[model samples]
Target chain A: MEARTKAEVLRRLRSVAGHVEGIARMVEEDAYCIDIIRQIQAVQRALAKVNDLVLAQHLRACVTTAIRGEDPEERERVLEEIVEVFEAAQKI
Target chain B: MEARTKAEVLRRLRSVAGHVEGIARMVEEDAYCIDIIRQIQAVQRALAKVNDLVLAQHLRACVTTAIRGEDPEERERVLEEIVEVFEAAQKI
Candidate 1:
């Protein structure tokens, strides 16, 4: 992964971690239920953004390397992994 | 939210907080990008469950109270809130 992307991803993930802890605090304080649910949704949205970043980075770096390399097995493996990722992502 | 639901929600959110922090550690360690994305997806699934619990509690208690109360305005407000939630949720 590029240094810039990794740093950005880490920053986002750390913020997400804090947001989640904040949600827990809200629940502990007995805040309005709808408000809590909205916070949860916000976290989900943030995670989705992180997921996209990681997947894009993977495709650009790791997957590209494997695909352009001289190993047929590695190429096949990377192709299959991409398909698997999309399958799992459909649920999200 | 009810006491039991609140406790469960808090427990889950705390665990989610731990999981998000763990993902940040994975990134810091330069773990595989696909693996990090999968971890992000797992956290999202956890958040969705929390959202469901909070929404169910709201519907059963808060929304029910509003609907059954003498204030028609409160009932309309709650109904609109639910609709808005669903519309937002459709993208997720």
Candidate 2:
């Protein structure tokens, strides 16, 4: 990944870490159900942003390599890897 | 996104299109059940790779923006969007 992109991801992750900590604090304080739910949602959103970043990187790097490679096996392998990640994400 | 990354995604997509065509041919020719399953698996794998690429980008851009923005609303919006996408993805 490019330096800028990497930096962006790291920055986001740092924020997410803080957000998650907030959620933990809320839970500890015996926060109301709605309040807890809201915090959870915040964390989920942060995670989603991270997920998007990773997906873009794979598309640019792995997918490109697979498509341009002369070796048929490489192409198939990359495709397989991509599909696998999607499947995993779906499960999550 | 950078030009190289964009090019990579496009290239991968092109190959996937070809792969899908192959699968269509297999189905058309009354291929064995196993053969059809294999093709489906191949398609799934290709899709997964693409998903990964997109996820990476979101983490880098959207997540970073949310974290850095001073507005609390922007941060909340980004987080919500991320969770929503992941939930949708799971359903699929």
Candidate 3:
């Protein structure tokens, strides 16, 4: 990963960790369940943005490299990996 | 939340927070994007489980109470809140 993207991704993930902690606190305090669910939803959305950032970079750099390279096996592997990611993402 | 439910929710949330930090570490290490995305997906799924746990408790306890109680306004509020939660969850 590029240093900048790495930093941005790390930052967002750390914030996600904070949100998770917040949810735990809310649970411990017996805060409203609907409220906790809302927080969980927010964290999931945050993680999705992180996914998009990482996926965009992957497509721009690694995937592009494999596609433009002469190694058919590498290209095929990357292609399969992306398909699997998207399928799993749909489940998410 | 009930004692057991509270403990379980907190435990799962702590695990999710740990996973988020792990993903941050992976980003810092410049791990493969697909691998990081897989981790993120796992975290999201874990969060969903927590949501289910909390929602179940709410329905079994709080929602059940409101339905059986005479507070029409509280019942209406909970119903609206649940609708909003499902709407947001669909977006997730």
Best by DockQ: 3
Off by over 4 Å in 3: none
Which stretch of 10 consecutive residues in model 2 chain A shows the poorest summed lDDT? A59-68
Q: Best-fitting candidate, measured by TM-score?
A: 3
For model 1, the docking class works out as high
Which pairs of residues have clashing backbones in candidate 1? none
The sequence of per-residue lDDT tens digits that candidate 1 reaches over residues B38-63 is 88889888888888899999999989
Per-prediction TM-score = 0.96, 0.50, 0.97
**TM-score of predicted chain B, candidate 3:** 0.96
Instruction: Return the TM-scores of chain A for each candidate in numbered order.
Output: 0.95, 0.86, 0.97
Q: Stretches of candidate 2 above 4 Å error?
A: B1-92
Q: Which ten residues in a row have the lowest lDDT in candidate 3 chain A?
A: A2-11
Error of 1 at A86 (Å): 1.7
Q: Tell me the tens digit of each residue's lDDT in model 3 across A8-87.
A: 88889989999899888888888989999999999999999999999999999999999999999999999999999899
Give me the overall lDDT of model 3. 0.92
Could you give the DockQ of candidate 3? 0.91
